[model samples]
Target chain A: MNIMTPTPPSKGRVDVDNFALSYDTLEGPVEAVSNASIHVNPGEFVSIVGPSGCGKSTLLNAVAGFLKPTRGGVTVDGEPIDGPGADRGMVFQQYSLFPWKTVKGNVEFGLKMKHLDKSSRDRAARTLLGLAGLTAFENKYPDSLSGGMKQRVGIVRALATGPKVLLLDEPFGALDAQTRVIMQQILTNMWQRLKISVLFVTHDIDEAIFLSDRVYCMTARPGSIKAEITIPLERPRHQSMMMSSEFLGLRRGLMSLIREESIKAMGGELNDLALDGLSIDLHGQSLADVL
Target chain B: MKVETFALRREQQTATGPEIGAETSHVRTVQSPAGAPPQLAAYLRRWLALNRRGLRAVLIGAISLALFLLAWHLLTENRVVFFIRFTNVPSPSAVYESLTRAMQDSTFFTHVVLSCRRILFGFSLAALIAVPLGLVMGRFRVAHEILFPVMEVLRPIPAIAWVPMAIMLWPTNEQSIIYITFLGSFFPILVNTLHGMSLVDPVLVRAAQCLGAREVSIFREVYFPASLPHIFTGLTVGMGVAWVSLIAAEMISGQFGIGYFTWEAYSLVQYADIALGMICIGVLGLGSSALIRGLGRLVMPWNRT
Candidate 1:
């Protein structure tokens, strides 16, 4: 992928090569992401899934140019990322919509920054808001919206700028399970319509498999890419696909990979010694048996 | 799992169907009706229901105040002298009579107006200077570092303590009084503005950046509006302090103001007038603080409820 392909010039190709990041703490320097490399082809949806504190968000932030990589670099369409720009849009898990601005105002923020005229900004905001089923709430402040609605607005606000790449950092993580599933559907629908490359980060295995064409599984802290698994599931995927044998197989594989890394991340905190007390309290029978 | 699928299906139906428009129109019709008299009645009912708790609170406050006034009337009218003497204090009726007399006198309005002018000038000047300075200090580390030490050193000194310096520094007594009032309100506004800036969520800033906001736009669009509620908090507090400092300054150095009127009454041994002046000061202070809260509500519509 690093080799300059003479193929047609397609935009939104993200490339992170051997990216590493570290930050200083009172005790010492802490390594966050270590030599992690990943890519999302133009117009493709990709996700990064890993155990907690696995630096998946760190990698995403670096790509967004909020933080600089300590080792290698991040590039989109062969141009190195110097800082955050209009070319990339990001949706945060916290639904960081400006409370002071109404829903339409929040969505039109990027357009305002671009100096788009009033009529165009309004038109663009309304169209995108309509797609997200938030047209009714365009005049309301973000504080009045539900969690799902707020994240949907977050996505709409990010997309309003007409960016080539969309970056989402656990966008549905704070939502309930049902909202999460519905949000995934809405996100995929938006992705298909916009035809923008996406780099998504989440800890949910089912979410990763459902949303991405390729999923990058990262190891625990001082995180590095452990595997890059491809999902052969057809497009226009549905909630029912989750029960399909193919989907379950992919889920099982990703789960085991993540489970191993999660246990390792706990660092002997969940070893046999921890279970020794449980067995003893249950009168020499397993806890499940006693129950 | 079944529930998840059911919810997802329902959401998809809502997303694609004409249900959204119908739902919105349904909400709109419920919120407002077209019939004039019926709508007015419904509005009145809703308003009454909403303010029922507030009405109870106001009733309680009024009763408490009336009881306190009754106690004052009893103590002074009877000239009670147990542990504390009420012999020299004027009764509430005497104070009310004095207040009625003062209201008829044109010079009493002059005293009230003069004092109001001083407060307005001083508090406005303080807010004008402090709000911007606080924003700058909060946003920039270098500004904070340079100004913080100086502010800390100066803040501990009460506004009353500045009266001597203010009188010496300014040519006119009016300017000196205003200066004292300014000093009283400035620090709270500045400190609270700084606090408001710090309290802004960093995630919002990053979100703005990703949305392609430049530095100036970020500060204007995000920082300024985000810190407004805090700035209003400062303004409300500063208004109270402004009144306190203004009264003290007037009493010490003024020839014609409410504070001076109260002092002159004390010197003249018109005990009833003294109580009248005290009541006047209390009413003015309460009114000004209420004005600040009203302005806060006006500016921050999102903060309502």
Candidate 2:
């Protein structure tokens, strides 16, 4: 696969050191993420997997310059991120394409803001749309497209701006199983061709293991890095490779790491009363024993 | 490989065929005859089939209106003296006769044209002022705080109540009437636009920011377009109120316009002409609202589905 436009060499390198964020509410400041440190080298694919409310999205948002860290710093290529710019592209889980614009129009938006010429904008948008297999939907509005198609357009729109890094917040979380698999494949193909660093946030263990070169597991809130696991899987991975023992072993290790944090996240919400029904029956036999 | 997968999906979708809605199935059953060569007839048949439900709704509305007219006719023709007396009320036939006469009279058209002009001036001015003000207030906290209090204090006072003050303020009756109409429509448009602005999804703003949109572009591209549907809602409601205020103001102060015509007919004891004037107002109000809706559809084509 030939690269349409060559990316700048060794540009996308993200570093977050001892990051902490707390938001104010009626009661007081609530801590979301604390003492979280992570980094992605240029042209690397990194995944952050944790239980809900583990601030995986917060970490991603900070990298995209959407939020200001209360403590510590975030930088890309040795320069601190002051605010959001075209250098870091973000794809939201909600398929946040502008409803008023067509797919191609959405893709052209960032380029337009960058003051690209009309012909160049059109060429860039069309090229990205073709790469995403959305040439048929170039003129279709975001509302008319299905979830999978809309997310594909979102990805294409983000990539059209030629960002050094792509930040995705569970971009495939809303898709059905079949569409999600296909989307993963499409995304990997695009990532390979673009040669850009990716910071993907997801709770799915299999998704994390399959897509990332390295996976970082975070503890429950206030979230911090729990473990960093390297994926030794070879490049150009196939769907059939998921059945291999090596893949299964990676999946098992990631799942247990996540399951422990998930249980802890639920600990505050689930009291003894909630677990009593699961423990024993009226006949004095434990429910687990009967099952 | 991706292309092949997409092609396979497309083939599957085509094999399954397009899904038809439950309402459309009945229309499909009443299809045009096979091998029919009359293109005009075939086209008409297809149109009728597509619009069967819409046609049924129109038929139902007409029947309901006929029933109301019959009840009114019966009550007046028999001179029924119940809790509310119909003895002095004009019969449906009398009103219809007067309507026909008024239709032929050039002066009645003059009244309608003058009234429509007032509404056009007042409503357009209201929309032009309110939309921008509302957008600014909705997006900026300082603007909202400064303007919102003033608006809240004045909003409770009806446009009809402003007629006297308008008469004293404006030099001419035409200006005063137009002012009243403006007062009637201004608040609804402003308030609804503000509401729309508040409802804009925060995630969208973040997405735009991530795409390198500055503050000005975000306001122009995201906030403005997102608030449009609510602005249209405001316009429709404001239009109705504008007509009400325009009529009231004209009846109070004007020498021309449909409202003045109706008041004049009542003074002269031409009860039938009074009814005719009211019918004219009804039809014109309905027509103008339909115009606004049509304009809305044109502007927001993506919202049609």
Candidate 3:
């Protein structure tokens, strides 16, 4: 994955070109992301892995059209994204399902918004909920469900409108490890079945490596794309693949990438610390010096 | 042979094992008797569980009323040191007798009906106007800025203070009393509805927008439902205030109503009728508030869990 080589953009591909986003605070304009660029081809699964405060979420928000980039633009399917559109759906980490709506009602929401009649809305909700194995709990409120179940409903609700791209901001970040793994499998299955583009944001290195076609590592604030690594694993990934050598290699690579950014962000001297058989330092030089 | 048969049955039961297990773990199911139909027994169990709480509440309430009655009897019987304020207050039995006598009088029905009508009309008018205004004020900054300061100034002036203005504004005494009642209830409902609308989760709004909901739909689906619990709180508080204003207005401008009856009784020095009037107002207020709470629970099923 060469940083200099641009991904071949196609129709329905999400492209962020030289994207820089900032927030206007009382103190000053604080830079969140700077000159960050990434692209996801149609039906490709991409994950952005970074340290805390690396602006991974800010970048994803820019894609979701919740926030406008200060410098660059985000284009989806060859069109500039002006605001939140139905074609780009989002799943949040907090399982932002409307608590007032039942599981079926939450899933039916997009269709209802699309002005689909009651029967078709019910059919669509039933189909999606059944696919997610949430049929039994259709009438249950979100507060009564497990965190994993709620997140599944969140996913279905996002997918209910049949969006072209799914922007997931740490969708499984709040789940327990076991549930997180199960949810990952469920997501993988859904993505495979639907063939939708995904731009997942996460701090978990293993999650990024396990779920993504390519993992993009981001530096700390003012954040920029640091590296991109291709995942050579085959699709329809299994839980057992986590123990394989290639998976472990990718995991180790992403962990170190995140660690370097985290230390640099902390203003740590980055003097040679004991790591996995590698001595690296970024004392006075830039992130590229060590990479 | 018997053991083999048992194992065969177990295997048959578990043929749909994984799916059944998943379903059971995911859905909270109540266990019921296997052979017999559990509908009757289930209904009975639920009914009993529900009424167990109700029964406890009723028992405690009855005991409390009895204690109050006994204390009232003792105090007015002129037997207690605390009762010796050269007591002119009527005894509990005397009040009870007056209540019975009033129940027999047809004028009592007129008084009760008139008071209830005024409360219902005034409260409905207040809610009709305030709820939409509050929602608009809360959603838009400019509307809030223009209206909130005015509301703050008006909210402090007690409903009793509005009686003179209401009398001057309306031609009839009935209209004036209703106006005063409306003024009393409008602020609580308005303030509460605004609070609820403002406190709606920003995350939910963003999620709704991303899910293809337009602004109008978002307000209808997300903001409206989100504000319901708070609206119910406002309704309950507003109902109470409506009753207070109604009584004050009725007392000030009299023809009929429990408030007028109570004031008339006080002037006539019939302390027993005064006590009865107070009791009637208390009972009606308690009932209405309870009804509002029940409605709130019905509307918000998620809040129950």
lDDT per residue, candidate 3, B1-305, as tens digits? 34445666666566546654565556953333233333566767777897998889999999999998888888888745553561777888899899889989999989999999999899999999999998889899999999999999999999999888887899999999988888889999999999999899999999999988998999899998999888889999999999999998889887999999999999999988998999999999999899989988998988994
lDDT of 3 by residue, A55-94 (tens): 9999998888899999998999879998887788899999
Ranking by DockQ: 2, 1, 3
DockQ of 2: 0.83
Q: lDDT per residue, candidate 2, B217-300, as tens digits?
A: 999989999999999999999999999999998898888899999999999999998888898899999999999999999999
lDDT of 1 by residue, A11-86 (tens): 8999999999999999999999988999999999999999999999999999999999989989999999998887
User: Residue-wise lDDT of candidate 1 within B110-225, one digit each (tens)?
Assistant: 99999999999999999999999999999999999999999999999999999889989999999999999999999999999999999999999999999899999999999999
TM-score of each: 0.89, 0.89, 0.87
Residue-wise C-alpha lDDT for candidate 2, range A114-210, written one tens digit per residue: 9888888998888999999999999999998999999999999898888889999999999999999999999999999888999999998888888
| DockQ scores of the candidates | 0.74, 0.83, 0.69
Q: Model 3: how many Å of interface RMSD?
A: 0.7
Write the number of the candidate with greater DockQ, choosing between 1 and 2: 2
Per-residue error (Å), model 1, residue A255: 0.6
lDDT of 1 at A116: 89
- Give stretches of model 3 more than 4 Å off: A1-11, A268-291, B1-57, B79-86
Question: What TM value does model 3 have?
Answer: 0.87
Candidates in order, interface RMSD in Å: 0.7, 0.6, 0.7
